[model samples]
Target: MRELTTDGLLDAVRAWVVIESPTNDAEGVNRVADHAGTLLRGIGASIERMPGRDGYGDILVGRVAGEVNGPGLLLLGHMDTVHQRGVFGYRVEGDRAYGPGIYDMKGGNAMAVAALQHLHATGRRPRLPISVMMIPDEEVGSPSSRAAIEAEALRHRAALVFEPSGEGGKFTVGRHGIARWHLRTEGRPAHAGAYHAEGRSAVREMAHHILALESLTDHPRNFYVNIGIINGGTHENMVPAECSAICYALVPTAAEEAELRAAIHALPQHDPDVRTAVTAGLGRPPFAKTPAIQALYNYAAMLAAEAGLPSAGERVAGGGSDGNFTGALGVPTLDGLGVIGGGPHTREEYIELACLVPRTRMLARLFETLGPGVAGL
Candidate 1:
């Protein structure tokens, strides 16, 4: 495979960052898939575009076979960002690229592409085949791409997710289990001025439920809950008849997940006069560390030292990613093999420019060493 100079990698990242592919924008995401497909095709990799679900863009999978093959290594990432088109401008200042999706993922995606290109140009035959799965809709919990991720993961011997690294360039070893719920409370509406005593306030009932749900937070145990969004009451003078809220829960263990779900479902009726409904939303099972995961971590750390990088550390991130799906499916998975950066899902999002080359080199080396029987751990 040909080598990619630092300048070439930076230019590729800039091109991807300016595309503006938000999760719900199919046309926008497809634009990105087209760009990525072109890059992969340049390296003679086989590409497949799977039709997306109704609201998402298509999924992209690229395959490059090794001289010797069986189950291969899987490189995983998502192409969707949370920012809407034109909300954030893409520009470079000093060593950072400021934009909507730069740090969150586009940078990592570019790194993966560059690495694959380098491998192909150098004519390096991997110990096993390599498959890159760049799916759409990860910022929305990967609702439509979960099946594809799991399917590819089951075929591969291991997975490396290109999520951003944790603080100080630590790789993510575990991620919290996530679940969401939508709640509604209904009550009788009455004129405040004429019949205040006769009205049962749904807002008041919902307030009680919110407090009860927030009380479930137990940080010491890695169990937490948040009443992220809430709306209640219509006008100043009318006793409101309806209230609604969106809640999210995160837990570190399966036992904690079950406990949190039970607590939410068993929430007592704050007011018998008011009716309450709770509906569960989509969920992602936690990605916890396992023996094979640790082995992969060890191998990567060894390669990092050989590559002249600092001793790589491991982290347990609070957010969820596509890695959660593969890890929970019992695949040996490692995450955060991307450019080191911070401030995801915010206006300040950016990746450290200096880390681009080293991280990509490290990833390529890991891909070479960790494939199938190479590590033998």
Candidate 2:
């Protein structure tokens, strides 16, 4: 088997870490997608660049011909990060490469690119064709890209998501069910000094709803509710008429997700004069562990051992990814196939620079063999 060294892998990926592509920056994200497209094209892969929609970067879809015909492998990734550009500056200290999206994704995408290069160097392709899809909205629950992601996944026999390697390089076999809602409250505006008695405060009403949402969190059941973004009230002396917030809910099971959804819709009115409503923004259904997923994971462990990488274990992650979309669709999906790293979604996010090559080797082997080797997938 050919080897892609850690140093070599870092060199292949460093250009990406330096390009800060925040989710909201369509142009920035497309630059990353463009770089990926350029790399895929160099390997003789046929490519498609889809225009960005709903204020996001374009999507890159590329394909490498295979040795035989099958549903083909889906190499899924994204270029969006939660951090605004410049919030993180790329730097390598010892074995850690610090950057905005390095650990969360771009590193993983680069590793996949190397795995493809490895295949080319070995003079071999997998039993099925390989398709690469990189989107620009995953960090924000795939609001604009979910449909495309799901459609692309349906065309594949299996999907490998390059989000980030779990701690100790564990494979992410499942993810929590997650959702977000936009909450708004409207009330009559009145002068605080004069008509305060006649006006109901929208901020006061929203406060009640926020507290109610927070109260829905049941730690024992692994369920949580949070209002992360809040806005309301234009002035202090006047009774403000509008209030808004973004609410997020996380749960491990479909039943718990249902309970949380119902609770949000059932919030009682704290003031009859105030009007309130909640609307869906972005979400993922629970990607539950199943027999097929377990089988796929087990075979991956075998592949890892054969590739001389660390022993692999299966885990259920709290966060959601495009993997959540594919896995929920009942496709054989394995996530966290990216570089080993820590502190995602923060300025401190960094990748363990040394784990890149080994992980890429394992991924390359999987790409070369999974379609023909894994049974009942």
Candidate 3:
């Protein structure tokens, strides 16, 4: 039951925030991965860097072995931010660290590392094996890391996701599964002035689909659908031949996912003048609040209470994380076990300086309490 000092944890946060790890920027993300590897190695964890796609950043895996072997616990976080170069400038004002990825992820990464460091310094061993997999591209739906995440989850008993805690440091028990797709419509092009009657407008066809897509939200099952981006018509004078749009849907459960997908696919292609096509599938399966997950949350809450910290039962809602990937495998998963903060994707994103230390201590205490053999297989 050793305590982690606030000053040391703050220093780690400062050091981590200085590195900008935007998701689309491979070089910058890799730089953060390098730094993470160094820190993990120093904490006596074995390290491995898995190469990503040709132009993507690498995934860092750190492992701390225990005396007995069973299903390990996976710690997940992303090194990528949504900010572009020179945007969402980084700064530290007093105890608050303001930056692009501060609250959304980088802060969580720091907390996870600090917890491991605390354990190492005190020569404490966990009851179960612990493995940390820090991947890039979560900000963009984890296109590159989904397979690896699922594989690791299948090999482990449970997973802890370090996406920023809810607005008030509440652990997330469930998150919405997401599906993103592109819609395209095609029509014959003709000169508006000379043969307006001969041509059909693809843009008009797309508009109809957009309206239909919006209607999917009418259901009260917590389904959300949005046509976020639309582009069509090269010039104003001539009738456009093609138009396209990108849309996203969020579902709260697996059954809801199937229902939504069927509805989206069944969208009427009623425009005889234009041909429409829809592409949609599961982006991430919904992470529901199952009984096994409740057990993990109860265990963590008990440890937090013993450590003189606020303890509440698991919270569930619609939001996606790497937890979705793991939960898809039926492995128990818990998310938002990081510092509490808000403004995730805005310039105002920040983490409370006060919660950093206590949250880290909470994580450390959980580690000690769950030390090998405490929870039998």
Candidate 4:
């Protein structure tokens, strides 16, 4: 067996972590893309930079040739995070390496880099070519990059998503489909002190919508609706003329997704005096674990055992990833192959330091062997 260390890998992860690339920040995300592109270019990966649209950063596409030229392995990851600038400090404490995006994905991305570098340095190459796609607005919904990812996924036989792994070395083999709904209510505004009777409150309408929306959550059925953000009103002295609520739904199956979509779009207006509008934003399609996915996991697990890493389990996660798009398209997809960690979108985000080398070896092994002739992809 070959030996590997994470000294350089940790540095690479830290390099990405120090940059604050929230989904809404184009400049920061572009900087991260630039750094990742340069690193991939160093690895002899052909680089293509797409300008970000709809207020997002550029998408970086890097491809490395393989021993053969057939369908390749697609590596999907996002540089955008939910954390804003300087959301938290970065440090290495014991086995936990803390940083804003490190645990969420920078760690996993760095692992991919380390694996490729190891393969390059060792004069080894995978049977199939590899394409690493860096998305800019995945945290929001991949609105700009979805088309590109789907296009690239169709060109590959398999896709490996670099989303953060769960606690205890768990990976996401499947993910629920996510759909975002934006609700807005327009009502008559009047003076609270004098014209209270004439005023129709938009907030009241939105509150009712929230209740109606939340009532759709059914844990047994694995359907969840979350109204995460809301904004309404100007001042307490005047009635709110407009209110908007942004929420998302998680559906485990395609049938449930259809039903949920109908439900969200057909939400009733509790206030007859106000005008209500609903905008259903397309979200990531669900990534269901098929027999093929299970077989892929079995192979990856066998490789992990060969590499002396922990026997990591796979799950159908509720969170969404770029894999949702590819997996839904019948392209074999394996997700959550990033660093093992628990906290995401929180200040306590950290990745297990010990899992670095072994996981990278596992990824490299997957890269080194999986292909049309070598493995079933």
Candidate 5:
């Protein structure tokens, strides 16, 4: 395989970051996907772009056939960012590259491309198959790509998610599930001054539900509940007839997820006259560490040590990723094997150039070692 130099890595990342693929922008994401498909095709990978559903851009799956037809490995990542166009643009400053999606995933995606180049150029074919799946909507909870991810994951023996590593360069061993609940209440509207007591204020009723939701947070168990967004009340002089709130809940395990779901469905009505409707949408199951996952971690940690990179410790991230879907399927999944940086989904996102070569080398090494029966552990 050809070596991935620092300059080459930086150029690839720059090409991707400048695309500005925000999750909600379908065409913007397609730009990046198309570019990535070109790169993969140039290296002899068969590219398949599946049309996206629910207003999302197409998902790209590039396959580089291996010598054997055995279970292959999956390099999973997302092509979308949370930032809007012009929120942040790409620029390299000394040893750091700053941009909207650089730290979150563009860097990681570039690294995967570089590693694949190395694997292909060596002329030493992989033992098992290898495929790279880049979805277009992970920032918005992979709503359109969940089925595709799960189906691809089932075909692979193991998966490596390219989410940005945790602070201190830790690999993700676990991640909490995300549950977004929408609560709406409808009540009679009345003029505040003229008939204050006649209206059952929907906003007031929503407040009670919000408090109840917040009370579900169990810090010790790592289950968190937050009522992040709320909209209600037409005017100050009128008792609001309609109110809606969006609550985000994080669960650390499947049991906790079930418990939280039951509680949310059983939420009581705060006002007798007000009608309440609760709907749960866009959730990812928690990614818990299984024996296979821990074993994979041990193998990867050894590779990092051999490559002279920092020891990658296990971590449990609070945020969710596409890894959650694979892990929930009982697949051996390892996450956070991407760029080393901070401030994801923020303006200060950047990646340290010093980690570029080492991480890429480690990834190449990982793919080489895991193929066939090379490391029969």
Candidate 6:
């Protein structure tokens, strides 16, 4: 089997990182999408550019027909990163590439592109149809592209998510589901010094709820709830009338998710004098580990072993990705297939240069082996 060279893959990675495609910057993401479309078109695949939802960014879909008829595979990636323009810029040091989205997903996108390019160049045909779906809002929980992801996954037999590998180049077999909530408390405002007895403090009421929410974590079962952002109070001397907070909860199973939701919805306002309200809902469902996923991971482990890599497969209970959407639909899905690196969404985020070639080659091999001409789906 022909493998992509380090230099060739690095060149693609550099080109992708140079294009700033932050989630909020529609124009920047669109530019990246345009460039990606050109590459896919050159591969003899039919390309489609779906209009951005509500002026967010465009979704790019490229399809390659197989020589024989079979079930199709969906390869997914995102063009958007979490970094803003000046906050994070692309830089390459010896053996490591640092940038906003380089490790988290631009690298993965590049890997996908390079894999298809190699397949096209080498005239390799898979046993099944192949489709590449590149969206622009995965970093933000796929608000705009979740529906498209689901639709595409439903059309395919399986999905491969390129969300970046775990530390040390390990691919993910499962990821926690996430729920984001915003809670607001209302209370009567009065002078703190003169009418303290007459006023109700929303801030105090929210504090009680925060403590209750924090108690939901069950580390043994990998269920966790964290209150990440909180804001309240206008002035120190005045009784606070309103408090707002944003929190997140993670569950590893569907039953656990339902239980967490019920708990969240059941939380009551502690202060009798204050009015409390909560707007809570599922942000993303947990990508539970299923038998189909185990089969896929087994296949991936075999491939990794064949490539002379370690075969110790492990599951983690942190972070959410677009895979959550597809996995929730009962599709066989594998995630963290991008470059190996750590510190995503932080200043130290970077990708290991040494891992680029091998990871890209692995993905390319998987694509070629599973593409449209393959029979058993």
- lDDT (Cα) of model 6: 0.81
Clashing pairs in 3: 126-371, 126-372, 127-371, 127-372, 176-318, 176-319
Q: Where is model 3 more than 4 Å wrong at Cα?
A: 1-3, 371-377
Mind giving the per-residue lDDT tens digits that candidate 2 earns over 1-377? 25688778888778887888888999899889888888888778999988998888898899988887878989899988898976759889997998888888889999998899888877877667999999898888787889998999999988889988787788899999897889999999999998899788999999999998899898887788999999999889889899999989887888987887898899999899999998987789889778888888888788778767688888899898899999999888889888888988888888987688678888888888776656465
What tens digits encode model 5's per-residue C-alpha lDDT throughout 220-307?
Answer: 9998989999999999999999999998989998887888778878879878899999888889998888888898888888988887
Error of 3 at 140 (Å): 0.9
The residue-by-residue lDDT of candidate 4 on 1-377, one tens digit each, is 12467676778789999988989999999999999998888888999999988888999999999998988999999998899997688999988899988977888888887788888888888768999999999888888988999999999989998897775777788989988878899999999989899999999999998998899899999998999999999999899999999888888888878887787778787778999898877687887888778878888888888877788888889888889999999998988889987688999988988888889999999998887744355
TM-score for every candidate vs. truth? 0.96, 0.95, 0.94, 0.93, 0.97, 0.94
> What global local distance difference test value does model 2 have?
0.86
Number of clashes found in candidate 5: 1
The local distance difference test score of each candidate is 0.86, 0.86, 0.81, 0.87, 0.88, 0.81
User: For candidate 1, lDDT tens digit of each residue in 63-177?
Assistant: 8787667888888988889999988788888978788888889988899888878777787655678888888999998889988899999999988898888886888888889
Best lDDT goes to which candidate?
5
Total backbone clashes of candidate 6, pairs 3 or more residues apart or in separate chains: 12
- Tens-place lDDT digits, model 3, residues 1-377: 13566667767877777788788789999999999999889877899899979477999999988656887889999998888777867676786778878888888989988887888878877657889899988888887888888888899888988888774767888888888878899998999899988889999888888998778784577888889999999889889889999888887777767876777688777668798887863388887777777877877777667656676445765677889888777788878888777888888888878887778887877765664434332
lDDT of 5 at 80: 95
Q: Each prediction's Cα RMSD?
A: 1.5, 1.7, 2.0, 2.1, 1.4, 2.2
Query: What lDDT score is found at residue 124 in candidate 4?
Result: 89
Give the candidates in order of TM-score, highest first. 5, 1, 2, 3, 6, 4
TM-score for candidate 5, residues paired by index: 0.97
- Name the Cα RMSD for model 3: 2.0
- Least well predicted 10-residue stretch by lDDT in candidate 2: 368-377
Where is model 3 poorest over a 10-residue stretch in terms of lDDT?
A: 368-377
- In angstroms, the error of model 6 at 253 is 1.6
Q: Please report, as a residue range, the 10-residue window in candidate 6 with the lowest summed lDDT.
A: 368-377
